[model samples]
Structures are given as structure tokens and as C-alpha cells.
Target: MDKSFKIYVVVFLLLILGYLYLESTKKQPINWFPSYAENHKIPYGTYVLRNELKTFLPNVTIDEIKIPPYIYLEDSTRTGTYFFADEAINFGDAEFFRLMEFVKRGNDVFISTHGIQIDTLNFKTKRLVTGNLDEKVFFKFYNKAFKSKEFTFNRAFINQVFTKIDTLNTTVLGITGYVNANNERTNEGVNFVKFNYGKGNFYFHTFPEVFTNYNILNTEYEQHTANILSYVDSTKPFLWDSYYKTGKSGISSPMHYLLSSKYLKWAYYMALIGVLFFVIFEGKRKQRSIPIRTPLKNQTLAFTRTIANMYYEQQDHKNLAEFKISYLLEFIRTKLHIPTTTIDETFYKYVALRSGNTFEDVEKLFKFCDEIHLKNQISMDELIKLNKMIEKFKNTIQYGRK
Candidate 1:
């Protein structure tokens, strides 16, 4: 409607178009963070797996293990398989010992990750060397019961495989295959391994992404995850870990609920807007408006005119001439820096030199000055001529000296 508003709309539209162009041309962010938290719904998050575990095992109670294993050991009755899904399996010396003792007391612990901290357990990972540049990596269970033979992951990633295993107390479950530079397929890389502890077992799998929401949602991998979970002892209750992967253990936060709910978020924005409007309106009312200031009118010209008019009305030409002559003599003394006691040739020469005027002109002006003092009354013609000469002399002099 308005011209300024139309300009604003055009500028806003241009900005939007520019942003869209930049976004199209800009490189998308690489999602390298492995957020395996139960609450996160990202591609690599285990929210679906956590939920599926709850649904599939309804009879078994699944409690969150927030604190360290030592604290968890305080609960004497708490006995179940502690499930952990993360990018890495790092543990403190105390936590490691606690977990070992925990499993020794008939409790099991399942860890699915790409990395493990302890080196004592006999196992070495061998990364597949290949030049085929294949994005999909495949894995299949060693057990023959899985009707669907092998499952292939379409995403671009590397699969960790256990090349060495302690066959004395460990058993290999699944193996990952990789193509070498020679175009030969090798299945020596094992993805799953189970170690027997005191009275329980420690299950470790390299492919943790298979249990994530993105993979588990796929029908092909859903069965794959179920088959893996089959290894867990169903007789014992489940203990879902929500602390290590994420740093928190809870359903959700109060701030999260406030932000997620549309009404609450909108309410917060509206309250902020109301506060801004209040500050603006209140400031306008409280602060005083600056008054427009006009400079005082110059009355020098007006005063000169008024004095001239009064003198004309009174017919005081002689008095005016006398006053003009006196002022001219005083100006020559002060401004020209010359003695004015005698109005002779020497005075005329000094005045002419200081005022940058002709000697003749200075002499003529002083002649009028002498005549004005001698005569009792001055004629209008003479007064006018005297005024002209005085004004001419003033124009020649330096302003600063004046």
C-alpha cells in the first residue's frame, strides 16, 4: 500500500531469495556425532531400540542405570543384563572392576560399540583393506536358523571386525565380509563376540548402528536386532543404560517440555513482545521532548536605522558630521597605531599607509574632518561627501585591527 512498506516487502523478498540461493549452494553439515542416547531420535540414536526393547519385553522390568556400576552394586536385589549402546566402550579402573564383579555375581552386561578400552581381553581388530570403494558393508549370523541369510547396510561406513579371539572362553556369533584389492571376499572379520565370565557372560558387538532407530525401523534389520537380543537372558530383568551414552538419565526435562509444546513457546514469545512494547511506550511517556531553538535576531542594523531616523527628524546634520569626524580620528589613532593630535601631511601619509589607501584620498578625508570642526553647521551635501570618504577609508583598513 505505502511506498516505504512496498520497498520493505521487496527487500525482504530479495533477502529470502538470497538466503535460499546460499542454502542451495552451501555444503550441508556432516553428521559425525554418534548420539546414542535413548531420547535422541537422530539417525544414529537408539530411541527406537530402547522403545522396542520395552515393548518386546513387557514382563521384564527395564530400569535406567544412571550412576556408576559401584552404586548400582549397592542395590543387592538389582540383577539383570546391563545394556549399553555407544560409539565407544570406555571404563575407569573402578568401573571396570565393579562390572567384572557385577557379572561374577551372576549379572550380565551387554556393550555394543566400535571401540573398547581394556586390552587384557585377547582380541585384535583388523580393518578391511579394499580399493573397490563400496558404500554397503554386509554381515551375517553364524547361526544357520536366521531365515534371511545376510543383511547389507546401504550407508557409507566402516565395519570393525575382531580378527583375533580367545577361543578358550569366547564364541564368535556373526562375521562381517569385505572385498580386498584382489577382488577376493574375506569373512575373517567377526562383528559379534561373547565371553564367559564367572557365572554370566559379556556380549560385545562392533556394529552398534544396527540397533539404532534408523536401522531398527527397517524391516530387514528389525529382525536382525531381535535375533541379537535373543542372546540376552530373558529370565533376568533388563537394565537399560541412559547415562553413559548421553550424560543424563530421565524421560525429559521441564525446559524441553516448555519448548516442545507450541502453546508454551508461543506464550513465551508473546510475553517478550508485550515487555518490549511496554518499555517503548513507557519511555515515550516518561522522557521529555526537546524544544526547537531559534537563534536571537541580530538588532545591529535596526538600531543603526532607528538612530539615523531620529537624527533626520530632528535635522541634526551638523551634530552627526561632528560625531562622524570624532569617531574617524579615534579609529585612526587606535586602528592605524598613529598619533592624531595633528591632522597634517605626516598624519595623512601614516593613515594612507596603514589603511592601504591613496595619500590624496587620506588628505581629502582629513580636510573634511578639519572643516567639520571649524564650521558651526554642516550642509547635507558636505555631510554626505564626508560620510562617503569615511566609509571608503574604513573599507581599505584590516578588519582585525578595527
Candidate 2:
């Protein structure tokens, strides 16, 4: 019945539909470490070690330790040999002291490359053999290359010169030879020396590549390792330490470092603070609650008349026809509280009984209301008939309830 109200309904529906479409297209972010692990071939050994260390050595447990070749030797705890193919020649005073302490405790140590320099002058002293050398050459040494199958004087001289001065019982078990500079062939000494220390013994060999997994299968090295293992008490567990320095700095993956449990609580608190800041700074922006009024040239009735004029000006007969039918349906549903699913015959009978209207009158009103909606367009006369039917239907429901 009202042109202005019909326009309001169309605008409201458009706004709601637009809001829903925008919300559906919004994107959400996701964390993806589980997917990353599955794609890469990294072993889960670090996780396994962390769990086992916690279980066995509760007091001595380390939460996390970076495996090396990435830091300096002085900073590392070299409890065992650093088994790598490359040389670590930059042994500072601290590193040297640690290595000495490790060996003095009777623990065996292995070094693959031979050119480790402790001090510049001491290294030169070891390199050169000068005049005024003492008659008694006390260090034990064994160069197998120089010796014949039987015992020989040349091999014994070198062995005696290299042996530990404090431990007279120390001996060189085996050796291998190499070529010297100037195309001269000489016994460049390679030997295994064993020294007694406290309750245990220290075994040092110049050639260390023999113990690597790549060369350990060789019969000679296999026998060497087996012999060493035999001397070690099986009751004490052996440590397979592989820590070394690769001369680099900073973290590998900073995201992994940040996401670790060590920083998880701090990250959570930081996120909460960010959200709180957002709410205070952006969400609390001053909003206008008082409605602003613009001076209208026309009053409420005049504005309503203008909307009515537009409807008539457009000559939108189909829209007007549909509007009349929808308005009547909604009005009847609201006024009588009758569900849309109710049949017209049932509705007519109830209305006629309650309103004391003749059954024929109610039937005619229902018929005209249905005819206006089913037609594509309605004439001015037909519109008046539909309006009259809606008016009568509303009045009957109101009076009957009283």
C-alpha cells in the first residue's frame, strides 16, 4: 500500500547481500612447519636425542645444543674427537689447554689432519733439528717405512727420540712413510703411540682418517679400532661426539629459533599486547552517536508524496503489481499470525468464522487477492480492488481478536 516503504525494503536487501559476499572472499593466514618437515629430508635425530638425554641424565640435560662446524674451536667443548675430512689448524691457547686436559685424563683422541699449530715458535722448534742436539734422544717414535722386516737401528733411533720422557714404558706400535720435498725419499713418520696415565692409557696416532666410516672397513684400520675397543671397558658407554667449527655465525632459521618453546610464552604475551594496542588506538576512535540533521525542503508527508510521484512517473506497472501482492501477504501473516503454509480455503474459513462475515464475502476477497499477484500487471481498477481486500482483511483480524 505504501511506495516509500517498498523502496526501503529493496535497499536493505542489497546491503545485506553485499556484506556477506565481501566476508566470504576474505583471506586467512596459516602456519606451515609440519608441511615443511615432510618436504625436507632432515632426520628426526635431534628430537630423539633431546628426549633421550632428558630421560637418562635429568640433572646433566641440555635443552638444545647446536651441532658444529659452525663456530670457533675455542668456544666448543671438545670431549671427543671432531671427525671431519678437513683440518682445524687454528688451535688457540684455550683450545690447546682443553685438548691437553682431555689427553692427560687417559682418554684417547683422534685428529684427521696433521698441521695443527699450537704456538708459532714451538711449531718451528718441532719442525727443525739443529746442531748441539742432546746425545740422549728421549721421545718415543716408530716410523714403519724406515724399518726393515727385522728390528733395525734407524727405526729404533726415531722411536726412542719421540717417546714420552715421563713414561719410559710408552711405545710406538705402528707407522707408515711418506715422500719429502726436493724429490728426496724419506720416512715421513706416521705412528701410533700409547702412554700410561693414571688408571687408564692414552693412544695417539698421526694418521686419523683410518677411523672414519669410509676407511674403517679397511682391514688394518678395522683391526686398529677393534684393538682400541677391547682395551676400553664395555660397562662405560662411549660418546659419539661430532662437534666441530665451520667458521660461520648467526642462526640458520630464525623462524625456528623464535617459535621454540623457550620464546613461546613471550610471543603469546606480545601478540596479546599487539591486539590490545590495536583495540585502544584503532578501535577506540571517537564515533558520532548523535544523528546529524539536514534541513529538508519538504515535510514527512511531502517526502512520502514525492516517492509516490516517482512510482507513478516511472509507470513500473509490474513492480507496483508485485509490491501490492507482497504487502498483502505480509500484512495478513503479521495481523492474523497465520503461517504462509496455510491453504487459502482454511484461512478463508477461519477469517469468516472469527469476523462474522458471510462465507461468500471472504471467498471473494481471497480470490481477488490471488488474482492480482498471479497477473503480470494490474489495472488501476484492479489495484483499488486488491487494496480494499487487504484493508478489509486487516480490520477483520483486529476486530475479531478483541
Candidate 3:
């Protein structure tokens, strides 16, 4: 590599570092994730709601339940208003059964989420998009005493309301709606409902976004939040759930800061690209040429032909025939695993069966070889005939003829 090219490479790397540093220093935009976590101070987080609960209902003990209900509800003596607020609440079979038993013991459970699998209550919700670009939804209560003016939420990106509820058992608490494309104010769906399970009750609210810092901070919408909390018995203890949330209960990975920040994320991507470019360019620069060499030539067939020519020139038929017979018998013993100790009752049968040749052909070949073995001298044509018979017998084995 040239010194000038090295300087250029160094300058390029410095430029990348400068770009990453500037990006990392830039101001971050607002995060709109529905964390539903009490720790988060973001718009969709429940930090404000979590704090105000202590102030709204003064002197009441509101314990945060970070564990699942199945584990928490093990103590049958513990009874209170179990409050849960999130985008969606998912409960396992064990958790659901425990909650039912807990509620049956004359305790209340208040859940505010868009979706839930509560087959015991037989309820389902529908999420809707507004007709206008600037979205809107009005939260209204069914009770006349709680109803003042309709609480309007102009920043709703989506509205989730109960499309179907067990009407026979459930009593409506509130509703949410929007203006349609026809310029008409149409009721969307049920937002809240109260159902009596056993001695206690289960209050289900579809619009959980209301229980956030954004809604609670607004004077116009704060009343709506207050009215919703009023359903719970203030005198009893409140169990605030923190387990089932879109955001994690704790930061599990150390790479969260690097991955979550926009600038740092870009820097990480550039680092990978730099590594790839380095491999491609440096490999081309330092790569050595692989030399081509000739392979070893096989001399096995040449050596065998030279030996056969020597035997033919000297007219050594008797010695040649002895060598050929010894080699064939050794091959039959080692390769075919058949004995050549004696041409006995079982020799012909075994050879025919193992070599895939007919019994008659195997018997005639061996008998002819035996006669040749007794001869003192044989002619060239007799030697050629013996080689042809051996080849034909081997071909029967190769072709799998029985």
C-alpha cells in the first residue's frame, strides 16, 4: 500500500468519526411509545397517574405490584382494589383463575386497557381510526351526576371501544365517539362497563390512554381521569400493576443506550460498513498469487505392460502362468473372502454365490485352470485363452449376472 493512500484512509476514518460525534450531540426528538410505566415521564407513561393517586385519594396505601397476580394472590388474607392500566392486559390460566377467586372474596379489580381476553365477562373491543387528519374522540359518562360536559380528546391517534359486551350482566359506565366523514357526530363504541362477578365487581375500561401524564396534566381532561378513579373504593388499599407493560419492567440489555439513541445507532451502522470496506480493499492489496504446478502421472499400467512384454520376448509361458494363477488365487482369498486351500465340495458353490456367476461357468473355469496348472509349457494362444476366460468370469461379477 502507498503512503499517500494510507493518509487518505486515515482522513476518511476521521471524517466518519466527526460525523458520528456531531450526530450524537444533536437534540433528541420526543418519544411517543406507550410505555404505561410509572417511572417514565413521557406523554403516554403513567408517571403522573401513579403520583396523583396518592394525592387524589390522600393517606391511602397504593402498593405497586411488579409480580404476576398468581403469585401475589396466594395470600388469601390480602384484599383490596387491584388496579391495572396498560395498552393491553394478558393473563395466563393460573393468573385468571386466581384473579377470579380473589374478586369473589368481596374485593374489586379495575382494569383499563384496549384489549383483554376475559371470557368470564364475555366482552370484546374495537380499535378505530378517525376520518379527519387531526384525530379526535369525546369521552362521556352514562351517569348524570358524573356527566358535566363531554371531555374532548383531540390528540387520539386511535380509539378502542367495546364493540360487544355481555349486555345482560354489564352496566355501561362511559362511551367514546368521533365525527364521521359525513360531518355527523356518531357514537363509536362503549368505553367502560361494570360487571358483578360474585360478591365483588370487575370494572373494565377500554380507553387506557386516559391514565397518562398528558391527560392528567390537562385541566379539561383531568376531571375525566378523576371521575374514572372515583369508581374504586378510596378507603381500601390499591394494588397498581407494573408487570404487564409494553415497556420492560427493567432495562435487561446493556446495549439499550447504543441501540435506542438515533445518533449512536447510526454510528454503529457506519462501523460495520467501515469493517466491510476494509476487508474488500485490504484483501485486494495484500493478496498473493497462487502458483500452478503439474500433478504426478500414474505409471501403474505402464509397469504391468513392460513386465508382460519381457515375459513374451523371453517365451517364459510356464513362469508367467504360475505368477498369474498365484495372483488370481490371492485375489479370490483376500477380495472375495473365498478359500483356495483345496477345490473341495463347497468351493465351486461358494465362489458362484459370492461372485454373482453361474455354477456351471465357475466350475468350468476352475477345472480349465487346474489342467493348465499341471502343464510344463503352454503356447501364446493358450495363455491368451486363459486371460480371456478370467476376464469373462470377472465381467459376469461386474455386470451382476447370476
Candidate 4:
């Protein structure tokens, strides 16, 4: 109804609209990574390389191994002789020795592009060495577009070869085609190698991308993957270590993630409620008009007459003389429109000139009035002369005449 209330309503509507706009934008779900497996028609829940192993190691009767996050290596047993490392991390020295023992017992271990911490183990002493490779090499190999971008395969598979060659009783099998730093294809002498450890044979392929579905379909890597799988004996139980299947590592329970999301949602709702409460309670209230009360008009004159009659009835001479001087002073001020408090000589001069009276006469009249009030004494004739002077001063000021 009021102007201020209308402004508040308009502001409230704009705030609601703004909040809705923000919510609308926030409500839209964000898609982080595209569904590459679905789009490319790959089998769900299987890595590109592991999927290839199913066909490649058909003779070995491959058994897919699903390792849970933060697993105890000792608690788990392998039915087949092979272990796969996809992208799993936090595998300590004890686990490494257990794995090496498995290999020593005539088992095959296959590790992918990342999560291969083989350098941490000492083959001669059968102990952990606490060794770490350059992280830059791993990051580049995993993230770099192998098919779209040209990358040298020389350094790519060299680590795999070095791992096998450095180990006890391991031999060089063969190498894949090498490329120069400029991505130009070149023969770097060797691509892959083989190692003989007692009765067990260690085969290492440096180019893990060759086994991926993207590379398997390509003419260059398909033969390499097929050739590698051809070495497997199907009669022996096969273990597809899908432990390192996806690039994701350090996974938490689904319950923990969901609980955190719910807490954040509750905090957001509480903040919205607080803002709404402030707007409703602290906003201005409606204003009302205050009524006016007028005083009785003629009260001043009525009081003056009442006081005058009382003074006459009492007949108190000293008080009557003081009252008469006060009334005459007030009458002169009101009628002449001159301030009673003004003591300036120029004001008296102006009053004398306007009243056709001498300056000495006006001065004497004001002096006598003051003298009567202070002395509290006045003759009847002096009072009559004072009244006549007051009447004459009033008539001159009121009529605007000399």
C-alpha cells in the first residue's frame, strides 16, 4: 500500500528470481569424463588390454582376478600363475616379495604402463630396495594420446626391457619397432626381451599400449599382442590381474562419499533458511499517520482578563503597581511590534520618531516603568500618565502615523 512497502516487494521478487537462476544453473548435472567404453562398444567392466587377454590367452583359460582396494596380499590366493598390475598403488615391500615368490614358483606377472614398482625389489637378496622411477615418464606415457600424437617408442619399452635384463637369470627375447625422439619410426636394435629364472620364464613387453583395444585394432600393435598371447599355454589356469584395470587409484567406500555429499547438502539448505529468516523478520514494518491536537484559541486573552480582575479585587498596592508596569510594557511591545527585550538606543529613537514623541519622553517612560517595578511604588497620577503614553504609542504604531 505504501511507497516503501512496494519497493520492498519489488526487491524480494528480484531476489527470488536471482536465487532461482543460480539454482537452475547449479541443478544441471556435470559430466566429468565421457563414456569412452560405451561409445566405443567395448565390453563393460573390462579394461581394453584385459579384454584382449581373454582372446589372446584363450589356450591358458584366463581367470580374471578382481582385487579390492587396500587388500591384504597374504590373505588372497591366486588360482593361476599370472598377476596383473593395472593402476593399483600402495603395494608395499612385503607384497612385492610375495609376488616375486609367486613368479619364482613358475608364475607369470604382467604389469601395465603405470603402477609397476618392480625396481623396489632386490632379486639377489630377495629384499625390497625402496627404488622409485621418474614420475614424469609415467605421467607422459599414461596421459599422452598414443594414437593421435606421435611419440617415440624407444624410451617407452626400454624400462620393460631393463626390468627383465636386470633381474637374475632373465634373457632378452625380442624387441618391438623403435621410433626416434622426433616420432619417426627407427629400429633401436631391440623392442622386447625374455628372461630365464630357474624353471620359470620372464617375458617383458615394453609397449603396453599395443595390448589396448585402441591399439589392438591398429595394424601396428595387433600382431604384437597376438604374438605375446600365443606364448601362453591354455592348459594352465590363467589369471587376468584386473587389479590395475582402470587409471583410478586410492578409492574410498561408497558410504563415505555419500555421507560427505549429504552433509554438504544440509549446510547449503541451512544457509538458505538463515537468509530467508533475515529478510522476513528484519524488513521494515508499515508506517501510520500521527493525529494532531490543537490548543483552545483565545486562551491568552482570557487568562490576562482573569488576572487583571483578580489584581483589582485584592487591592494589593505594591503588587498592583508591579503588575500595571508589566502589562503596559507588554502592551507597548505587542502594539508597536517592537521586541520588549531590545535595549538598543536606535530602537527607542525609531519608536520616538514614529510616535511623534521626543526621544527624552520615550526614554523617560521606559525608565519610569522599570523604576516602578524595582521600587514597587507608583502614584495614581503616574499610572494614568503611563497608560496614556502606552495608548498613544500603540495608536501611532498600529495606524502607521506620526
- Top-lDDT candidate index: 3
Q: After superposition, how far is residue 385 of candidate 4 from its true place, in Å?
A: 99
lDDT of 4 at 186: 38
- Candidate 1 residue pairs that clash: none
Could you tell me the lDDT of residue 372 within candidate 4? 65
How much lDDT does candidate 4 score?
Answer: 0.51
For 111-186, candidate 4 gives per-residue lDDT tens digits of: 4342344554322111111122322121112112233222222122223324223546654444333333464443
Error of 3 at 290 (Å): 13
Which structure is stronger by lDDT: 2 or 4? 4
How well does each candidate superpose onto the true structure, as a TM-score? Answer: 0.55, 0.28, 0.62, 0.39
Candidate 2 per-residue lDDT, tens place, 64-168, comes to 223322222334343332222222335534344555565455444433333454232122112212232222211123434433231111111112113222337
In model 2, residue pairs whose N, Cα or C atoms come closer than 3 Å (at least 3 residues apart or on different chains), thus clashing, are 69-244, 69-245, 69-246, 70-246, 139-161, 139-162, 139-163, 140-162, 140-163, 141-159
Ranking by lDDT: 3, 1, 4, 2
Q: Estimate candidate 3's alpha-carbon lDDT, on a 0 to 1 scale.
A: 0.81
**Strongest candidate by TM-score:** 3
- On the 0 to 100 scale, the lDDT of residue 58 in model 4 is 56
User: Which sections of candidate 1 miss by over 4 Å?
Assistant: 1-33, 179-187, 246-402
How many residue pairs of model 2 clash at the backbone?
10
Error of 4 at 16 (Å): 12
Q: What TM-score does prediction 4 earn?
A: 0.39
* Residue 127 error, candidate 4, Å: 24
What is residue 30's positional error in candidate 2, in angstroms? 41
